[model samples]
Target chain A: MRHLTDDEIQGYLDNHPDSDREKIRAHLDICGQCRSNLENYQIIAGQLNTDHIPALSPGFTDAVLSAIKPDTQDVPVEEPSRLIAWMSAAAVFILGIASTIYFTGSSVAKNIIALFSPANITEPSFVSRYKEYISGIDLDLTLVFAVALVLAVIALIDRMIKRRHKPVSFMI
Target chain B: MDDKTSIVRKIVAGDKRAFRLLVDEYQRLVNHIAFRMVSNPGDREDICQDIFMRVYQNLAGFRHDSRLSTWIARIAYNCCIDYLNKNNIPFIDEEFDETISNMPGGSITPEQQLYKSDISNLLQKEIGLLPVKFRAIITLYHLDEMSYAEIGDIMSMPEGTVKNYLFRARRLLRDRLMLKYGEEELRQ
Candidate 1:
């Protein structure tokens, strides 16, 4: 009869389901070499099966807790309601500005053109009139509103992208 | 809600105490993976901290698809792999036989092998000489008491591969032990 392979011996000692224990036992009755191999593997497996976790540094939990304290900036996921609220705010702001421009007939583009015109610059009253123009013109408010809208849109897109690709450290 | 979901919710809600509880719960599992994969003594603690930080950072993304411990263990394993790569250590040593064959002989006597403590110490030493992947498989299997399926999930390998590597690692450890102190001595 052929001797048991090392895999067979180790598997038998490990109590592996695939190992035929009765047949191996019958074989062991006739084979001393395979039994010896099984005994050696048994010793090693016994040592390994015991819990032998290496010691971590004292206060490991404390250290990790403290390390994560300042670093745990939880970026809340944007809910649909919240996204809608932002969009609504942007829409209302734009609509309000458009309505003001439409109803008041304040032509911001025409004022800008008038301010930069050479004819307006060459006049002696240009500085005071320009100061008055700068103070009274709605272009500043419109410009401010437009800048704020651009910023808000950029921030919203950035948050969406971040949410979509939030650094998945390890996906199972 | 389940304990895991509750803790995860509390953690995601900026509850530091809940996060602390999580750290306390899974620190051993994380430390085991880190200690097995990372050889440097100093980097071990740092790597553990890094793993937890990543866990905290990404907890919101966890969808309860697996056990929390298994998920944290996966992070720890990946962090150690990153450390090994950054430090230019080959994660899988190609010439692993040289590692075993080159082990100094007769350094451990049969008398030393008689003591369980001595045998465990020698076993740890021999395990350290294994390739990185094998060492991790051994650690997760024996120390962590994880199933082959769970280990396969963490290491991103099939269950069969984990079992095979585990068998090979044990066989290698046995060979090394028998080489240092002969088979009859180990039977004692």
Candidate 2:
């Protein structure tokens, strides 16, 4: 008969249910070489079976507990005053732009009016012409442009804030 | 109704004390995986903490498909692997011959190096020298006493693969010990 393989020997040592323990035992009883191999493997298994894991330092649990943020799942409520301030500022800017468009009759205002007018919907060529006209016109619309940029920045910041405070679901 | 379900519910309901208890329960298992897979001592603590934190974050997604310990171990294992990848550490699955032949007994105490007869210490050094995955398998199998199927779930491998790696790991460890100290000393 062929001698037992290492797997069989280990399976025997491990008392693995699938291993033919009686067969392996019979072999080991007669086979000195396989028996020696079993003995050596047993020693290795003995060393591995020992609890060699080092203990983590004291207060590991407390440190982790302390690090956990409280109410992590709760969404932070946005301040109503901040929201009001943003809305008021936006309203003031829109009012300023409306006043400028009404009083100045600026060519920029004409293009802006044309860009939104219902009459321009049917005239496809008016879209490209409007773009060309707006690009060519040198209006002193720095205030308007600056206000629009600020509003955009404010909207982006609001989105970021909302995202940061979004409530996490407790269950999937 | 069961203890695990109740504990998980308490934790999901934002119970800090329950979370603390959960951390206490699994810290040893987490530490074993972290220490076995990650070599850097300095990063081990942080990695362990991160593992627990991740467990907390993802606990809501736990679907009662596996044991809580097994789920936590899977988190710990993945966290260590991610740390290894992020740090550009070589977690290769290469054969152990070159590595074992090349690896010196890992950073040992001067006294340990001097005596060199402590079999447990030698075994630990050899374990450290194994490929990361093998070290993890050894820890999960022998230290944690986890079932092969549970280890398979934790490591995202088949049970057969886990068994093969475990057998190969033991064989390599045995062969190395035998070669170094001979059968007589090991038999003792």
Q: Which candidate number would show the highest TM-score if scored against the true structure?
A: 2
lDDT of 1 at B87: 95
| Poorest lDDT segment (10 consecutive residues) of candidate 1 chain A | A163-172
Q: Candidate 2 — which residues are off by over 4 angstroms?
A: A71-172, B98-113
The fraction of correct interface contacts reproduced by each prediction comes to 0.57, 0.61
lDDT of 1 by residue, A1-172 (tens): 8999887886787677889999999999989988888888878878887757667777987887766534334544444456655765775677676667666677874575587866735656777787788879655666666766775676577668766755333221
lDDT for position A71 in model 1: 34
TM-score of each: 0.68, 0.70
lDDT of 2 at A3: 95
Q: List the residue pairs that clash in candidate 1.
A: none
What DockQ does each candidate score versus the true complex, computed on alpha carbons? 0.28, 0.28
Error of 1 at A12 (Å): 2.7
Tens-place lDDT per residue, model 1, B67-170, is 99889999899989889889998987655564555755436566555654478778877777788999898888877788888999999999888888888888
